[model samples]
Target chain A: MRRLRSAISTASAEFQRHYAHNRRLAEELRERQERARHARPQRDLDRLERQGKMLPRQRVERLLDPGTPFLEFSSLAANMAYDGESPGASCITGIGIVSGREVVIHADDSSVKGGAWYPLTIKKIVRCLDIAIENRLPVVHLCDSAGGFLQLQSEVFPDRYMGGRIFRNQCILSKLGVKQLALVFGHCTAGGAYIPGLSDYNVIVQGTGAVFLGGPPLVKAATGEEVTVEELGGAAMHTSVSGTCDYPAGSEEEAIAIGREIVAQWDRPRKWDCQREEPEEPYYDPDELYGVLPDDIKKQFEMREIIARLVDGSRFHEYQPNYGTTLVCGFANLWGWKVGILANNGVLFNDSSLKGAHFMELCNQNNTPLVFLQNITGFMVGRAYERAGITKDGAKMIMAQTCSRVPKFTVMCNGSFGAGNYGMCGRAFDGRLLFTWPNHQIGVMGGDQAANTLAEVKLKQMQRNGEAVDQAVIERLRDETRAAYLEQLSAWYSTSEIWDDGIIDPVDTRNALGMAITASLNAPLGESGYGIFRF
Target chain B: MALALLLGAEAAGIEIVRRRPHLVVRIDGREHEVVERDEADGRTRIELDGRPLALACAADGNTRFLRLGGRNLRVSLVDPRDAAAAGEGGGDEIRAPMPGSVVTLHKAEGEAVLRGETILTIESMKLQTALVSPRDGVVELLLRGEGQTFDKDEVVVRLASPSAPGPSEPAPPEPATAEASPAADAKGAA
Candidate 1:
């Protein structure tokens, strides 16, 4: 592979403008992430400190290997929900190295509402477990929660993928021979108790950590027998009397130490062999990515420039470079792991779709993981494109991508709209991990297009009813629709709703994908075969 | 083949004669023994033909800057392949690489432009590509205006002949062959 030639002029006015704009976005992202991770009400912090407990992040840091990176799932999981009450969905989940073994950690943020489980919190936890199951990674559960938020019980409890799915995933993970360890740091009442109950091994802190089907008040109300929490399910009762928990610890720190030792005893996953080489730093500065990305979402920039800054040694071997000009399919090493990258330079044309489908097939056959860098608007839409079988070609691409046995990862670099999302491994495609940049937007169509489409429908409806089509009303409607669409299309909303795993800083993309790909290798490749090709 | 190293206005040819107990190099047909050592103070000591010289060196891409004897000097390595490729000058007419419409015109006719300055921007297949000047010259004509469409291989801009007088100068045209040779020589020198 040869180093990609960069044509960017860092001293140009455009570069300066984009650098300033993107730097501001990145700074804002850092600020929000910092606040979400650490900021808490004084009362909550005081309560935890009084109870002799560590902050959720502190617990996670201590549980992880000293200096290993933790790829946190969603720091702003419920930033837009619960009336700004639940930061990080009142929980923390990420992939981290525990006792020299790769494990997914789910720590309950006890600093918020006694670490209650909101609707999105359950979704986030379930998503993490799902990742664990898919990648065959072990799980370390930091058990602490006030059960489900009762006010939003309808949304959090009854649905198929709500609270119940978390336990179901836990059961499946255990049944699949994947290891799970629970370190009880606080109350795990009702359904939360099942987290520790179902784990392969569990440890409970003496004074603060407790697991119970119902806490003291609930026990009093249901059975009319008033019992203390320690007697009901504390470390001494569960570990000694009930035999529900495996180990007892004097404090949270001791529990973490016990948990680390337990994790060390688990067998290491036998990762399937894949093409790997000595990792190389990208020749181009990854910081230049701020200038490479455009300020405006509609503007176009070369995807090769992004790939050059992301891949090893800034090297790429482009596949079908001339045949499909819009979709750049290539082979590059991401953190020494050989991966096939499909990046969208423009709307998908027939040839581009065909090229992508072929490239995906090649990657699967060669046991290489697939990485999709999506900036797609949509496939070409016109009489000419329709006649050219663009729909069939797109189907071929989607089919190939969906059936890919190789681990797939996606980065929402910019726009993701319409069916282009499907062909490029959108959230529904079961990508091993999907991350979004702060500037990313995802919707069925762009805000302006959706607004115009709605306005046109209204105009036709008014004409059919023989009513006056007020221009002011139409304009107002258009503006309102566009505003609403823009809000929903934003990366914050997508992440808050758990549409993606999380929003990542653009420069951290390489590291995030590296960790994801490494975790994905724990599982062998899936059975490979496509249902059918439209071609 | 000896590699070319450019130091200010002078060019030197250097080839490695042998790599053994000490490095041996032939510079401009003279064999010289060279050895390098790093001092504790982060400065490099170079023994060129057994004459010790201490310098601090910093490198950026293919160019190296040295601070020696209270003076700063820059030395750049020029790849023979790149020099050979740069020697082939572009044609007088700039043709479209693909069927596209001009989106922006950065340069106008009779304007002096640098070798790599953007002449215009064209949009095709939902991508915009910038067309840059092939060489330092005066633009004689812009065949397409903004928003005007053109076919592939069609001439989009034409440069004034090297021998012809520039529009701004209004001077008499020189003999074509007699002026072209010196212009080529000047480009090579640059």
Candidate 2:
């Protein structure tokens, strides 16, 4: 009996101690939960807005560190009409911070009238592009749209392209150094496809979202192809072929997470890309190309073959397959260096001078290499010039080149004359090296020159009275004199020599250019950067 | 395959009256000889005053190859500083070259714009990448907003711009011994 009482008392004491400890632990847990709940809770509206379910104001939360000091620009931006009217506006863009990186974004929500881009959207985007280029910012785009504005097309009306004035901002971005990327969610098609297409990197939600150049209806009408929108322009289609999107995701959350992840891929201003798994040997040796071209100036040549032979064959890209025909410009891999290259075409005259200038400009902008092959005669002169508006159109080329700061090289294949020589970076131009085939002959005059010279000599000798053979000699000498004048002009040391950095054997031209470029790269800075001599 | 060769008379100093991008030559060595070519189509063209000679050859003349005159030729023109933007793959903006209705702003204005981001959704060729922003910049301005239209690569946004202005400085020298390429960065961040 005594032992049982003692055991009961001990057990009661143990229970009291256990109850007090449990109560204290539970109290602490509740307090921590309360604090966490109040600390920067994710706003429901913000989540809904991103899901294409709310307005911009509703989606925007404190984008900076909660309760930390930060300045807000254009804090009250909204689509409130002049008369306080509520309308369909799809994009919401403004300055804010996510983890301290100051950035602006143009977000389109598909739930809002299919997220169309109208005149206002164009202006808004242009403004964003211009500002980014001018400031060299790291741009981010949060995209979710069906495509263009079908309903609001009539709201902002203009005679020419409906307010396209701000469209040039893209070039400005390219000219300057800036970083851009696209994130896709929901249905993206047609115009929406480009958002990720032209970016440095693209991320897309695999199953929940898709991107295409045209939606199914348009596709069916245009090409009689009645496939689903996603089937035609899905994440896989974009990332694998067409060289459009770079990254593909499985879900919206994954896409956004990838967006945040990609944004931090490079340091603040510097840019970057992923290296693809490729073969060991390059496409071909640039040196083995001595016999790939025909000596005929009028013959056609495969430009891509040459590029493949010169660079890593498997790692080059060409843009605008149908735009310019006179010249070629794109990015390529040389040795291990990533670079931009501009080449002149041998058979197309889409815009010779204009193409040349563009090459120069691209070289300067991207610090790439510029190469030219001398294959010319004269532009279709006179009436043809008027029809092509050569003067106005051609000048833009020079402007682009004149502003370039990249290295340049040229090879003289055949007959270059007048502006022709200039176009090929002649002694009077900016080629790092100039070389010509042994069988080359450049002159200002052709066929009639030789005939005239012989005629002039014969007539002069025929004069027995020693009287000067005036008119006959003059008329006969016309062609020959012109040829001789051209010859002398080309040979003048000042004309081609002092003006050139070097001249080499045609076969060794590529090596010589490579050497010169290595030596002059990022050399002394100056006004002579890309300026044309004697222009 | 039609070709022509041009040469300076007497091989003296070269002079010029004009320079165009492409040229064709007509040669005759056999009965009823003929050829057609588009050399300048895929190659870079230089308009320098030099000599060129056209030659005739067999019709089966290695169509897979490029023939210059009677000899075969190949020319390479790749740059040395390609990267994200000018690199194989990177994000870039495609803005409008001029204002127009969002007649077809296809891509989402914002998202993960890769090296070739196409935000404006422009239309040309009855087709378009039509407008793209050149460099990587965040969509800041977007004056047109969606469902509206505007002109050119305008200030859509102050994208990719360093959030806040850095020192009133300019582009720094390229980093030597690059620890990471753009591609690596993309993968690393992921």
- Which candidate number maximizes TM-score? 1
Clashes of 1: 0
lDDT digits (tens) for residues A51-165 of candidate 1: 8888888899999999999999988899888888999999999999999999999998889998888989999999999999999999999988888999889988988999999
Predictions: Cα RMSD each: 7.1, 35.7
Worst 10 residues of 2 chain A by lDDT: A1-10
Q: Score the docking of each candidate (DockQ).
A: 0.08, 0.01
Alpha-carbon runs more than 4 Å astray in model 1: A460-469, B1-190
Best by lDDT: 1
Residue A269 of model 1: what lDDT?
Answer: 97
- lDDT per residue for candidate 2 within A140-168, as digits (tens), equals 66677655566665643453434343334
Lowest lDDT block of 10, candidate 1 chain A:
A1-10
What are the candidates' interface root-mean-square deviations?
14.3, 33.7
Query: What TM-score fits each model?
Result: 0.82, 0.30
Q: Tell me the deviation in Å of residue A455 in model 2.
A: 7.5
